[model samples]
Target chain A: MPIHYPNGRRFHETNTKKRSPAPKKISYSNRGMTLEEDLNETNRYYLEHGLAVIHKKPTPVQIVSVDYPKRSAAVIKEAYFKQASTTDFNGVYQGKYIDFEAKETKNKTSFPLSNFHDHQVVHMQKVIEQNGISFVILRFTQTEEIYLLDSRFLISYYQNMDTTRKSIRKSDIEKNGHLIKMGFHPRVDYLKIVDSVYFSN
Target chain B: MPIHYPNGRRFHETNTKKRSPAPKKISYSNRGMTLEEDLNETNRYYLEHGLAVIHKKPTPVQIVSVDYPKRSAAVIKEAYFKQASTTDFNGVYQGKYIDFEAKETKNKTSFPLSNFHDHQVVHMQKVIEQNGISFVILRFTQTEEIYLLDSRFLISYYQNMDTTRKSIRKSDIEKNGHLIKMGFHPRVDYLKIVDSVYFSN
Candidate 1:
C-alpha cells in the first residue's frame, strides 16, 4: 500500500518509504507500566489544561457477592464481566461526544482487524448513527507509533478482512489518520485532533 | 416531605408509598432475593428494549494477587480502589449524555447526603461542567419510591450543608424530581425524563 505525500512522493511500507526514525528514546524506565498507564497520565494533563475531557470507561463487571465487612465500604467478593464494552475511553470534547477503541499491534507490516471484536464494531456503528465522533487508536508497540483512524475507515476495512488485504499498511494509515505526536506532559495529545475536527470549522 | 396535586391534595409517603412486604416465611425457605436483585432484573429488561443504556458502576477494588491455573481464566489476586466514584450508572439516552448516582435509603423519612461521598460530589460537578446531564436516583428501599433529583439541586444542598441544611429535604425532592413509576421491565425508565429535558421543544 502507498500514500501520496505533500511532495508528490509515494510512501510505501517497503524500504523505499520508511518514516523518519523516532525522535528520541523516553528516559523513564517504564519496564512494567502498560501503555494504559502512560496514556492515562497524558490524559490527566489534558484535563488540567481544559483541552479535553476523556476517561477510560471502567471495565463493566457483574458482582455475584459483596461482603459488607464494615459500614464504610463494601468488598467485591466475586465478579465477572457482564458485557463487553464498545471502547476503552470516551468523553465529550468541544460539544461533540467522542468515542474510540484503542489497540496495540505488534505486527511490523500492518494492523490486523482481529485486534477488534464484533461488539465493538456494532458499538461504533451506533455511536456514528448518534452523530458522535468515533475512531480507533492504533499503537504499533515496537515502533511506538500511534495514529487515530476514523471509524468509517476502520469498519470498512474490518468488514472486508476475509476477501481483502491481510491488514492495513503503514502507508495507508499515514494517509487517513492524524498522527499523534508523543509529548512530555501527555504522551498522546489527542485533544488537539478533537479541536481540529470540532472547533476549527 | 409532601407534594400537592393540582386538585389541592397532598401526596405524602405514608399514603402513596407501599413497602415491599418482608417475606412472611423463614430464611431457610425460598425467601427470594434482595431489592438489588429486582433492580438488576429490571436493568436487563431496559437494555433488551433499547430504552436506555445505563449500567451499574463496578466497585473500585485493590487487586493484590491472582492465581493462574493452566487452562483457566485469570483470577484477581488482590486489588483496591484508587479512589471512590461519584455515581453508579452513566450512559447516553436520546443523544443526551446522562450520568447519575444511585442510593438506597431504608429511611422512609428522607435520603441522606452522607450516603454520597466527597469524591462523588466532585465528579458530579465535573460532569455538569462538561455539558453532561447528571442526577441521582434515590430508592426508598422499603417504599420502592424512586426519585430522580437533578445534580444541580444536590450540589446546592451539599454546599449549604454547613450553613442552612444538612440534607436535601424530602419535600424539596418531591417538588423538583420526576417520579419514576416502577415497573418489571427497565425497572427505572429514566429516558422519559431525558426526553422531557432534551427533546421537548
Candidate 2:
C-alpha cells in the first residue's frame, strides 16, 4: 500500500521513506534565507576556521512576568522586545576591536540614512575615537550587492544631513565603500575587506 | 487618617523612615546592593564619564511561543532562560578588546570552578588567542574584595582541575590577580586595574 498526499504524490511502501534528491543547481542565496541567518553561518565558519571570533548580540527582551509552574523550570509569561543600545555584531579580529551594524535595503539608487539610529551613529563615533574599527555593512538587496562603509564617512554624512541629502547615493557608495565579494564557505568575507582597508601597511 | 499595619503601626506616625544628616562614617561597600547591581552602576558611570564603554549582556531567553493579540505588541507567552554562549561583559577600551565574566561568591576561602561553564572558558581562550584582553572579575562578597584574574592563569587552572583542587584559593587569587579598589562614583573601579595591568607603560 502507498500513502498518497493531497497533491496525489504517493510514498512507496519502503522501510526508509526517502524523498527525491534536491536539484544540483540550486542557488542558496535565493533560497529565502534571511540576511541575518547567512551572516550567522559566516560567523560560525570564521570561528571554526580560527579566523575571528564574532557573534551577534542576542536580542534584548524586558521580562515583565514569569510563572514557576514547576520547580525545575521557570516560564516567562510576558515580555517585550527592547531596543539595542549598540551595534549588532562585535568581536576581536587581529588584535583590533571590530564593531558593525548590518542593514539590507531594496532600494536601487540610494542607501537611506533613516536605517540608522542617532544612538548607533554616536556609538560608532565613540568606537572610532577609541581607535577601534567601526563600520556598517549595507546590502542593496535588489542588485545583490554589499558594501562596507567606514564610520568616518558615515558620521560626516550623518552630521551634515540637515544641509546635505538624507541618503547616500549608490554612486558615492560604489566609489568610497569596499565591495565585498560573495563567497561559498564564509558567505560574506567582510574581514578580507577589513584587512585590506584597516590593517594594510 | 493614616494607614495602619497588622501590628498596629501607623505608616505616617513612624519616625523610622526619617534620617538625620549624619557624620560621613557610612561605607558604601557594606550597602545592601548585589554585585550585579554595583557592576551595572559602575558600567553606567564609566559610560557617562567617557572612561570606558562596557555593558552587561542581557539574560538570554529561548522563545517558544508568542501571541499577537494586537497589532501594536507581540506578547511572549512561553519562553525559557537560555545559557549565554559568551561572557556577560564585552567592549572596547583604548583600542583594545576587553572581554570578561563577573562572578560573586559567598564562600570565604575560594571561588568555585562550578560557577563557570566549559564553553565560557573556551570562549575566553579564543579571545586571548586573538590577542584580546580577557579575564574574570571575582568578588568575595563576605570580604568585599574583588580581583581581576587573567585568562592565562584561569585556563591553566581549569585544565588541571581533575588532579587539583576544584576552586581557586583566595591566596592564589591575591597573588595572581589585581585587587580592584572600591570607589565612590564608580563603585568597582575595575578599569583602573585594567589600565595598570594591560596599558601602563
Q: What TM-score, over all chains together, does every model reach? A: 0.75, 0.84
Q: For model 1, state the Cα shift of residue B171 in Å.
A: 0.3
Model 2: what TM-score?
0.84
lDDT of 2 by residue, B104-127 (tens): 888899889887888899999999
DockQ (model 1, Cα): 0.13
Instruction: Give the range where candidate 2 chain B is weakest over 10 consecutive residues by summed lDDT.
Output: B11-20
Per-residue C-alpha lDDT of model 2 across residues A1-201, encoded as one tens digit per residue: 123212222121121111112222223454543355567778888888888889888766667766656336667777766667788889999778899999877789999998888988988988887788999999887777889999998888888887567999999999999999978778789999999999999
Q: How do the residues B33-123 of candidate 1 rate in per-residue lDDT, one tens digit apiece?
A: 2334344455556555665444454444444444445665444433333355546566555555667777766667767878788878877
Candidate 1: stretches off by over 4 Å: A1-33, A60-83, A163-166, A198-201, B1-52, B80-83, B163-165
